[model samples]
Target: MNILLKMLLSMSIASVILIPLVWFLKKVFGQFLTKRKSYYAWGVVFFFLIVPFAFFFVQKNTEFLWGTPSEFAGLTSMVIGQNGIEVERSTQAVIFQFIMDYVWVLWLMVGLIMLVYRIASYRNFKKFVISGAHYIEEPDELDILAEAMETIGLNKPVEVMINPLISSPVFFGFRREIIVLPSTSFSKKELYHIFLHELVHCKSKDMYVVFLAQIFTCIYWFNPLMYWMIRQLERDREYACDESVLSYLPARDALSYGDTLLHSIVKSGTYKESHAAVSLHENAKMLKERLEAIASYKKGKKGYISFLLLLILLTLIGILLNFYEAKAFIYEKKQGIEIKKEDTSKKTEFRAIDLQNANQDVTIRKGKTESFDLTTYDENSKAELVVKNGILMYKNANPNTQSAIIITIDADKVYDSLSIQTTGTQIKISDIHTKTMRIKGGVIIAHFNQIKADTINVTTGSANVHLTDSEVNKGMKFNGNNALIHFEKSSFNNLEMTSFLSAKLNDLNVQGGLSINSGGQLDARNITTDTLKLIAGNSGNMKFQNTFVKKSSEFQDNESMLLQFDGVLNGQTRMSIGPSQTKFVIRDKMQKYAIDAQSSQADTFILNQSIVNYPFTQNLSAPNNITLTNDSPFNNNFNLSFEE
Candidate 1:
């Protein structure tokens, strides 16, 4: 129950509790926070309070439990308590400490990065406002906008306000209460089209999402992806809106709306109202974006396949958000209890010593560069393990078993290896070398390192693993039935592996790589990195994907290679190749890519996918490209497809 309370409390702090705080800030310093206050009161306040603590707490607790004592505790706890004095021997008190070893400091820096990002988000939300459209209202335009509104069956009594101080299209603002326009134009059809667009924003109640995203932004400022998700949500909302509007409006009129949007682009560079919501101030870039979107826009409802893909993406994201833990610890100290990073010394801390028997909490501390190992028989104990200075401590208790490790090092150095004997179902730890940390377990979560380990091994059972940092290094292999691994940030080299819960590698940077082996289910998304190697063996879901990079050109134009393969292409030859430049930033299931090819490949990348709203680049290039195309197209084929 205590453990449950802590878990609930921590989650509340990161989300529910945190969002309100962001709201409070907006209220308290509305005017002060911004000269450009767009959703200032709502977005920043929510994001500010929740993102930092939620991310930090989860990262910290997981690291601390890197290697605690669980297997032994479960095996002996029942028999030992009854025969207390007889159990003098197992592994001496697993002298496990915290996970901040000299080697892990680099990873720990990630926490700082998140902090920096959140702070900037806070500052940005408070500062940025839409402003660039030169509203050329020609007076009496309200009647036209209002008449158009009625034609669309919108009779909720809309407000037609003339913003002599404003600029841009007929905007629907703050809950769709006001529709402002340029004193000059818009025909009945044109006006109706514009109304439909803005109304779509309102119908979807994007106003609410804009508010929600603001909250997320302020808190998770460091995670660029989070912000991108917000934009994506808005973009999707617009796409969905566009589809809805198409139901009533004609093609030519819709095209006119697109044209008018372009004209507005010519007039306004881009005006952000400094509020939480984004309104109609379409600029040149946005104009081009809208054109491209409309050009590829389908007329009717999306099919099951489209929805299935959407569901998969949403499900994967939700799973990541839900099945996460944030463990904590407490501590009391001893003099010079020298601990080693590799020693399981204080394995069970006087197995003879029981919390009920001891008058006070156990206290164990060590000198500089020390370490400890631990195991927990209680389910409650597995979640949080904290240490003060050099001491190891825990609270409450659990009857279920788990294991973890604590290795304390300078916040300035790095480490080499973290090995876990496959014993319990879970292993929690942090701060270590960027090397391969092998574990024989069912569930795994590691935090912040350069070259992260792979394989959350299980002999015959099942395992689920998640790692986080800049990218994924190597991912998990399913030797058993339902063994699954999920890597965040770093690189991957899994050409083949199989299973029910399979391994998922995400956020492979422009520098990261992924290799999908045969018969293995490898789903790669959000590969923001440039060069990656993919080899989908005989049969498997080697889904090549990418996401738009929010990074500037100075940082993106790196000479990286992205290689993928499966079958033949360019012709029916044994093998084929072509020139291309398509890079992906692999997220768990959502990947965005920038493809620049003169002709489309039937078996290459499935085009006309979810309506993606991103600027196109002319400088994109990919020279050494492989093709997975065959004589006949590979429809819904999971295996590889080389594009020539």
Candidate 2:
């Protein structure tokens, strides 16, 4: 249904742009277009109207241009919860969604109404014409019809009838051709001319064109230009049929044909047009123009080929631009360098360690004595390991080597500083004490277990970092892009984490404060912090379960956010959300907390599963205070619940 609506919208917009352009080109280069070519130019409009469906079909069948790595699906699902958590929606959001879900039904209803009305009208007109009609039994009329069919090169048999109800000569029916003429006396030459004109319409399949135009008009009933285009096409059909008849006649017979048209117009009444039929004379409004066109008809140059090609090219370009998909590239691991299994251990005395540009798995642990072991991938690859001024510095010359170069370091003494930087490396550190430690890499996988540090910082691009059973005395900081950071059973004095992707913290305890800025999802469970500050952007979500803040805490998001607190709130917390939904669920109902929530009138706030008018407040004098504010004009949904 969504695809159908999109196709209809595309067709409508394209018609608006192309219809007028075709009309203008015809007017500007009218002399260069023959009547047949001018009528056929409308085919461009019809082609573009159906082009969107072609794009939809191609996208569904082929993977040539739209092939993407499947890993991105996992990544996206991780960033957004896979279980599809339900979130409250504002009134405006609900209305907008309702419209999107049922707008097609409305369009279909209108289109059906137009179709049924057109069919009924056509049926009534057909009945009225057939009721007052009789088959031509005159031998002279039959001979004239045979002569006209032969002149127009029409092999199919046609039924000729005379109807006293209609004033003009018209042809109807698709499978069996029927030509209905007014019940009036005519000379042999005039009868021959009228028969030739209607037969030309039959040979050209002008009724099919009118039928198609009627269907399109029904489909695009909301577009006024559709009606205009159909009217214009009807006029063009008559002119082209006239031109075809003139081509079959002698040059002097043009005057006789013009007289017959004028006579039909003089006798013509306010007869309604039927899409299922083609008439010789339309109306007085188009009669003068038709007579002038007949008098001035000449073989014109076919110069619209370039214009038609240009229209097609533009339409193709539009399709390509609109339907282009993003391509995702997958990373493949290369195998070339060899790993040496033999460990080369060396005694080293250093207070600080620094390793840079190492493409390998590295482990650092505590030992009784200070020593280092090197496991090289390539023996020829020179690696710099030196101790200078109480600092151990290591650099790998061939950092681009594919295989692992494991460097396990063991030190008994607590180091003043420790730093490691690499690209696409796996690092593990355990039971090492340091005043300050920093790790930086690209596409890194790092783990810290039972490690103690005064200050620790880690930065990476497209990485996964885990900290388990670790403690930081001073502060810890993490910055990453397209990365996932996880903390389990970790304690820190002041922890600050920033991720462009996702982060999960479980069983984490912060002595001082905890701060997190995420561009995706952030899930924290069993977390205890003295002070908390969290900022999320671009549809980022933060879900906190069994989490407690001791001091003042602030949470802000530019998009949708979900915060679940199963524990007690001990601080003055402030939540600022944007146009998206924000859900707050507190399972500890016994924990008394004051709430002050404010938002625009368009927003909806549900408290304890019931809609509450805002700016709403409750338990204002309570010790624990919580403030929620969303002032965007768009719908901002707030679901606040307290469950025992």
Candidate 3:
């Protein structure tokens, strides 16, 4: 996933789950919490957004590295002495920009906001005792504070408004609203329950909590986790506030208050305020917990030991999630001109992965073959990596879009890294194997640990070529048109091809025989190898182009290698042979050569027509050679040469 998406997803999940969870937990536990802790509880919740927040910062860091390509004004730092003209190298600028994107110290800002909001909500102390406002006209009849807004003082004073929803005198929370009850029907004990309950909300400033919860919710609207969290907080909040009120009431009064609580709980409704830090009314789940709190109230201070344990549990969770916040990002798009930033990392080797590409299908089994008939290949015809260890085999596995594969590694463990470029690369499971890959164009580069692939092919194309550390196995063949092939430390059995195509195997130890097949010619320069075999047919030619070699890795066992040339050569195919022995069997085209076998000592010769130069080193022969004149030994009267 891209950084933005990761951040957004994290934030949304935490906020969505946290909101309702907080609400529900607070509804159950709110009565037990000291007012300050409830606000602190909320402040602690937004603290969880840090991980998602990192996503936003990392992306901004990337953008800073690569500014808009079509630039106009320079930043103040670049203004030095000219007309604000400054040029930044892309790599250096990006790295420096990452440093300048300084997001590390910003997380404390969320912490600071929480601290400041909590403090400001309860900054001053004010005390008030006033007769209830006539609230019978409005629901939350106790909400007469809204009607008496002009006269209501900061001092905690009851502006009695009857709850139109519930006539029972139950305390509903609003900032600085110390709502007084009417003396006509209410006893001192019933009135006391209302005063202490709402006072706790005002003191805790939970009215501001909804605001804080909403900010996180809005940012991570997509996350169910965050939403779940929010609901839990709200539920706990109510329970905590209820606990505070019960602390001052008699058991009889607590029972009396329970009736009013149950009545109001059933009739509760929502408040229409978008402000942060304050929440009104209960969610469906929160309402259930609030009703349960009336019956579930345990009057005893949770065994001093349990409270200590609870504190310890809270402290540990705080330490973990506090330092690491789940972060989310918000982006605003600009119109008209576009700013694009592309970041790329150097490709590193991961484990080996396999893919089928345009040049070769690396058959899974030895000497196995599979083919795709759609011959019109293009650059966009991407190959799929059947087995992907990491991003090395497939571009789809990477999040950054730039193609690279990074392995997931243990801290100190070692892993092997391998890569392959897909053009004219082949593989054989056993020794002395040849698999011809026909490439219309492109160079193939591949790597293997011990015994890997067989050969590589280069075909005609309107492009320049470059190959490094490329190799092919023994007994491999190359056949193609006017293509330029380059190699370094490359292994091959016998090189033969047609046209102006040439491969400069620059490595000092090139073991296999080098030959130019007769259909076309190849000119290799500074190319040195052992047991050079050259063949030509009519117009084919392979020139020295001056190639040299020091020593050659000799052929081991007879079963270890095979170099067979079945193609017909028309013109001169020549090579400077090194001291190693390589057998060459040329089977066809007697008319193309002047049979030069008489010049070299023979090991075994079957000169039906084709010739092998300097035969003292190894065997040179043909398969079946037969000729008949007017009177032959086998056929006395039949002339196979002179047709009737």
Q: Pick the candidate with the highest lDDT.
A: 2
Model 2: how far residue 404 lies from native, Å: 50
Flag regions of model 3 displaced more than 4 Å: 1-43, 50-155, 163-188, 265-292, 302-644
Q: Model 1, range 1-644, lDDT digits (tens) per residue?
A: 32322333344434443343334443454333221122322333333333323334444323323333333321222333554533222343333322222323543365467556645653463333223223335444556556556656666655544433344543434533555554344555655666666765555556666656665454344445455545544544554555566656666556666675666544432334433444564345655765676665445443444334433443343333433433333222223422224555444222111112111112222225444444544545433444433233344434243434343443233324333343343444444433443444333332234333442232324555555663224544434345566766755443223443455666755433222333446566665533333333333444444433222211111111222322111111112222223232222211122233222334343333332221212222332222222222222221222232
Candidate 3 global lDDT:
0.40
lDDT of 2 by residue, 185-229 (tens): 777888899999999989998888888998988888878898899
Task: Please give the CA lDDT of all the candidate structures.
Answer: 0.40, 0.76, 0.40
Candidate 2, TM-score vs. the true structure? 0.45
Q: lDDT of model 3 at residue 201?
A: 61
Which model, 1 or 3, shows the larger TM-score? 1
Residue-level error in angstroms, candidate 1, position 505: 64
Per-structure clash totals for the candidates: 127, 0, 125
**TM-score of each prediction:** 0.32, 0.45, 0.30
- Residue 215 of model 2 has an lDDT of 92
Q: Is candidate 2 or candidate 3 better by lDDT?
A: 2
lDDT of 1: 0.40
